[model samples]
Target: MMQINSNPILAFLVTLIFISIPLSALAAKHNNATEKLSLNQDDIHGLWIEKRKKKLAVWIEDCGNALCGRIYWMKKPLDKKGQPKLDPHNPDTKLRNRPRCGMKILSGFVKNKENHWQEGKIYNPNNGSTYSSKIELSKSGILKVRGFIGLSLFGKTLKWERPEQKLQHCG
Candidate 1:
């Protein structure tokens, strides 16, 4: 005959280790899921800042049943003469006097099949050129904006970050 004995503490220790390991893994997974960025289209409405090197803050919002964004703020809103910065580089001479601040730089962005904003135009105040553009908000909260003349393959993408605090429009 074989003799069998049960130890309560040893059994409890085994149970705890077995239970806690999977529980820990599950907890970590849940945390990661919660951290994932929102995929909802409306989540894109907010203030975004490009690389500080540009010193620009853009405000994105719903407009005319689509997405639109504008430059509401700039680090230097004035020119050397202490006057509002103008879009002198614009091809259209009439629009050259428009202020860089409060300019409608992004327009006509509609949601595409992939939920990204597409079929839009982004105006480059630097060179006063407009390019067909598309935008996507990533799972990590980075705004990926692409500007291309013809195909997306022939373009550049810029990553914009969200500022921690509210930024006042250029004054």
Candidate 2:
């Protein structure tokens, strides 16, 4: 057996090679994970439906420099009068008469970092409430949406699924 002190330079080089191998591997793994988490414009540009209530479907599309989602369809489109549903709960009386379909419910969302969309607001037609929202896309094709009153800790999280691409239309 050779003594390490007898050839210090060779021993150091061998140790460095072993250390660099794992470091390089770790760096590569981090890069791949970041890439997988990153979101692209097209990744979210489609119809997404609430995982719980299949009644709501939103069409996400590019709007200006950000992304917006519009209520394209509803399971129950007609009201008591057999007329298309209106946003009666809307705070603005002027908009109350407007149909719910084709109404933009998600707005002002811009990609902030990989896999995240921030600085957005989500309107809840069910209660006529709006809240600050952020969205994160998962590798499993689910959009995790968080709606908060003020702080995120006081918010609700809901999962929306990207259904099979279909010719979705608003009623």
As a whole number from 0 to 100, the lDDT of residue 145 in candidate 2 is 85
- Model 1, position 55, has a per-residue lDDT of 86
**Candidate 1, after superposition: displacement of residue 16 in Å?**
34
lDDT of 1 by residue, 1-171 (tens): 422237777777788999999999999988765544442223788788885465888989888988989897888888999999989999999999988888989999999855488999999999989999999877667788999989999999987877655688885
The Cα error of candidate 2 at residue 88, in Å, is 0.7
Off by over 4 Å in 2: 1-42, 165-168
Against the reference, the lDDT scores of all candidates come to: 0.83, 0.84
The best candidate by lDDT is: 2
